[model samples]
Target chain A: MSRWEPDARGRLERAALELYLERGFERTSVAEIAERAGLTERTFFRHYTDKREVLFAGSSALQELLVDTVARAPGPATPMEAVAAALQAAAAVLQERREHARRRHAVITANAELQERELIKLAALAAGLADALRQRGVDDASASLAAEAGIAVFKVAFRRWTEQAGEKDLSEFIGESFAGLKAVTAGT
Target chain B: MSRWEPDARGRLERAALELYLERGFERTSVAEIAERAGLTERTFFRHYTDKREVLFAGSSALQELLVDTVARAPGPATPMEAVAAALQAAAAVLQERREHARRRHAVITANAELQERELIKLAALAAGLADALRQRGVDDASASLAAEAGIAVFKVAFRRWTEQAGEKDLSEFIGESFAGLKAVTAGT
Candidate 1:
């Protein structure tokens, strides 16, 4: 918890989630969260815009990771394949944070306001992915379809992974969920 | 315009959308919406809880229609088939409202807060569809996957339908979108 530590942001996030879970998101204050982390409110503000940001700070990075992967995918890969590959690659960013992700998910799911924010974040991710696809010369409708479907696959897979207690790889679950999506769409 | 008219809700919705589009959602009040509709504030309150609800009043009915269609689909139909059928069936509810739907879509798309609510409604519809599938004996994961994929298709198809100015039926667009989803997932 020293000021020189490299995990200041991570510590703040952990503390914020703990306080939010214990006191309810509406009841938790930034001061209390910072105090719990052995840091000052200024430090909390330095890391996050507000308490809600602690739960959603990864969204921008996740979107960037997805778009970058899609843009760099092999030429032969189809739109969905590119998206799936992007999802697989993005897993690395989340792999080591399984516990943190699960706790964050729980906090978000338990609160209606937080859930709305989560959906908005997911929608933004889909939009960003679609934009990335269009940049790769994919048509708008097809780009949107692939991106939205990829997000749908991610939501289901992430829920399963969190519930499984890190027993399975996030990428493996994403692959399986993508296969499940294919199966459902294939009508068999 | 008469007090005895049966379309109080319709009148209020049209007026509300007009006001929202002109002055923006935040600036539009229920009193202004009601006055624009030639009705009193009580009538507006009677039909919608707030200004935001005016844009989303159809969500519950839309969810019911989807769940019912899925529940009543032929026993031999696959989960995706059931969802596709539900989307087709649900289209009937929206088919005649093309202009209204387009305007509503415009209003929601122009505002971030409304877009969030739209996403929340779609998520709720997905959850309802998954629940209906489970009631028909499908497993949780498969039900959720189909439901979420169906929602993604719906979102894409709806946007296309609105943008196309009703040149084709909503159901047709939905079918084509579902096919596109299948093609994307199939990696072809």
Candidate 2:
């Protein structure tokens, strides 16, 4: 087994999702994932700490992207506007990987433990966005509310985006969902 | 060892919280909790499926309260208004159990697994609220957005309510949080 495997990370992710879908997440093993990827278990360990980590490997990166976008919003932007911009930025990134996002959503939706992990990731992203807002001088209560509301929009929009045919962009759904959130909150 | 234990449920809950606080949730056992409460493990099992269930015992009742409130809102009430009413109703219930809620919050905050469980419960509550809104003729997207936004407000308000001294009522905090939510979403 050569140590210099090309695109091992991507291959491992694809293999893991395929196995997770073919056999339930609970039934799939790291060894099988490695083998299915034409790689060694040692290489799998090098890429991810555990089988579960394979499914969640992108979460931290996504959170960082959200926080960065929030921090870099124009100085005069409102908290919700900043949050909306960050969500749209995320939507743009997700739009480039629509198939992967759909498959990953399916895998997470089929398993309770995965769903819990997904919730934790979303919660952490909200916290990160709130921290970014606070750094921008938004008050604590408002910062937290805007970030949470933003994540709520993202969740709804992302679910709708993944469920629909590939006609509209994820960013459009995000924009519409944010508008929907505003309408509902406005009691309209 | 009698089967007819008085206040067994309450005793078990208090005992479980105490043990979880003192020894941590991972170290606490059903047998120890039962012993602390002066009941047997059988009584504990009868009341709760596991040690973790002690902290979440009220979730279903809380969800029912929220759903019923949403369902019974005035015909002309907006989705957010109905959600706000449901949240206020829940706050009123939690107001009476401030100390218990505080301690439980402490225990759950200290543990990752409990926090995940808490997130799952909140997600379920949001789903229930959305369903209730849908039943009230709200559109699917509007119902989900309102429910998720409502839960986000509840999370922030409940946290603030628990963190502060009992000078203000939970319902008041709920009202303020909903206003804050509207303000942020309105981009004020």
Candidate 3:
């Protein structure tokens, strides 16, 4: 069986996170990560280019969902709504795996280097999102602003979602944050 | 007659930018940068921690100014106004050194690694600004949103300011961007 399967990627991420949590990020090599996952380093490399990448491997999927959703948003969907829809799509994909997401979040927040890489990824994601909006003829400044606003909402809602054990569904929290951002920005 | 004078820092930075533009960041070394400035490498180390830092040595000063402005803002200013005041203060400082600012911008934009470092510093600056607003009794969500919004305006204004060549003032452009942002976020 080839290692280039979606489940294979998920398994590698799970194994890496478990070891990273137990032994920490700096000390855990890819070899150790693969061994713990009952897979080879080659398999691990095929899935993730580096240990730092495991935390971000899903970003590509998220980006694709965001861009595709924004592109197909209904008429009268503003940039923010288009992005909000994308966030809802992502919530559907992520919210079901709550335990895994929480565990990964804990490990990421504890490490500064990982946090920096994560920030960079988010910045890139924001830029990509803005580009998607611009492609829909949203003009440069507005496209950028709306996309950034949406990312800010995503950040806040994601934090809230992860922090609350059972307070609200991810999609619901996202909706609230979207309305909140629009409300906040509305007040001039 | 020593180089440890008040204006010595300016002299060093000038030399560094000139060397970087002439021979590039990698081709230039600390000793060369110092020597070009008519100072010893020891003197350069006294001012800046590293060679790459010469490009970004303004960050801490900007952070301090923004934080102090936010903390001391008049009580009735809305969250956005408080954040905007911090950005206006930064515009004052940055516009004062427009030539050097433009030079550094050109150099940093040309290099990938430097761009990454620049993004990291910008992220930290935004975080520091948000924390400062939060300290001023603003709620976390509002504070972060204001700070992020301020940064968005700054990015747009700074890009416009840096590219202006025909005797344009950065401070004026900053003012315009602030008004534009407020207008877009207004009445909706």
Candidate number achieving the greatest DockQ relative to the actual structure: 2
lDDT of 2 at B42: 89
The positional error of residue B36 in candidate 3, measured at the CA in angstroms, is: 2.0
lDDT of 1 at A142: 87
Q: Model 1 over residues B1-60: C-alpha lDDT tens digits?
A: 446756999889889989888988889889999889988898777777888888887888
Off by over 4 Å in 2: A1-3, B1-3
> In candidate 2, how many clashes are counted?
0
List, residue by residue over A1-188, the lDDT tens digit for candidate 2.
24589899999999999999999899999999999999999999989999999989998889999999999999999999999988888888889998999999999999998998899899999999999999999999999999999999999999999899768999989889989998998883
Give the C-alpha interface root-mean-square deviation per candidate: 1.6, 1.6, 2.9
Q: Which pairs of residues clash in candidate 2, taking residues 3 or more apart in a chain or in different chains?
A: none
lDDT of 2: 0.93
Question: Per-residue lDDT for B26 in model 1?
Answer: 88
Q: Is candidate 2 or candidate 3 better by lDDT?
A: 2
lDDT of 3 at A138: 79
RMSD of candidate 3 to the true fold?
2.6
Error (Å) of candidate 2 at residue A110 is: 1.3
What ranges in model 1 sit over 4 Å off?
Answer: A1-6, B1-6
- Candidate 1 vs 3: which has more TM-score: 1
Backbone N/Cα/C clashes per model: 0, 0, 0
